[model samples]
Target: MAERADAARNRQAILQAADKLLRDHEPGHISLDQVAATAGVGKGTVFRRFGSRTGLFQELLAERAARLGAAVESGPPPLGPGGPPGQRLLAFVDELALLAAQNIRLIAAHERACGADPHSDPTYQRWHRHLRGLLSELRPDADADFLAHIVLGGYNGELVRRITASGGVPRLRIAVRDLAQRVGDVD
Candidate 1:
């Protein structure tokens, strides 16, 4: 039990170090050696724990996504909980737009480097399906899943690209609000 606890602590330390470095430098620029050195561990330990750079990045993304999930869980009203379904939908897009703005570069690098199954990820899949369910509750007439995908694809997915192209967040929230109103008004 003591050994297990020590191992867990060591892993957390390594992850923290890696996360710091990733935030400080571009993901591609940082190496496993830096991560191990920052964590005060041997390079072998990093390899043994994460296998490769891609694996480490995956862990980092999972860690970030976990934190993101927690934030959504405990965040303010219309996001965490306690709001009308339509409001919640808009909140999701607004929050997602913010996240993309914050992590645009790292995310672009991650998308290029890892290119893994985005939908297969549990967190993403859950959010996608949950939004569909909520949209259905908010508007029973439309095809919930398709409509959810359209909104996410049209509004959220384009946020990073639009921000990069425009050099800002733009009026994303307003556009999303208007889009949501239009969608909700559909019979």
Candidate 2:
């Protein structure tokens, strides 16, 4: 039990350090040595815990996705359960766009390292299902699944990065709001 607790503590430290580093610098620019130093752990500990940089990225993605899912499941506001379907959907898109803007560098690095399609990822699938369910509530006769896919395209990391780089986060949020409005009108 002590060993397990120690392992958990080490894992949390590593994750916290990596998350801080990723927030300060792009994932591609971060090294495991830096993570280990920040976490106050040996380099071998990071390797033993995560296997590789790609594994570390995957874990980070999963953690972020889980947090987002929890917010949508039980948190307050338009992104949660209290709002009208249209408002909730729009809020969801806006939130997703912000998250994509914040994490695009890490996400892009994960994609490059794993060569996995973001759309097919389990986390993305959950988001798609949530959107589809909301769309179905608004327009039962329409193709909610396809519409969800289309709506999610606006929140893609690459698109968010380009828009924000060219303009800013506010511009990207405006674009996302525009897309959400159009999507919400698909009844």
lDDT of each: 0.67, 0.81
Off by over 4 Å in 2: 1-3, 23-25, 29-48, 51-54, 65-67
Clashes of each: 0, 0
lDDT string, candidate 1, 99-137, tens digits = 666665545545545556544545456667767877888
| Candidate 1: stretches off by over 4 Å | 1-3, 29-34, 47-55, 71-76, 154-167, 170-187
- Residues 1-187 of candidate 2 have per-residue lDDT tens digits of 2569888999999989988897888767888899999999999999999997777777877787776788789978678878788888877877787777878877776665566555766676898999999989888888989988998777656777789998888888888778767766832
Supply the TM-score for candidate 2: 0.77
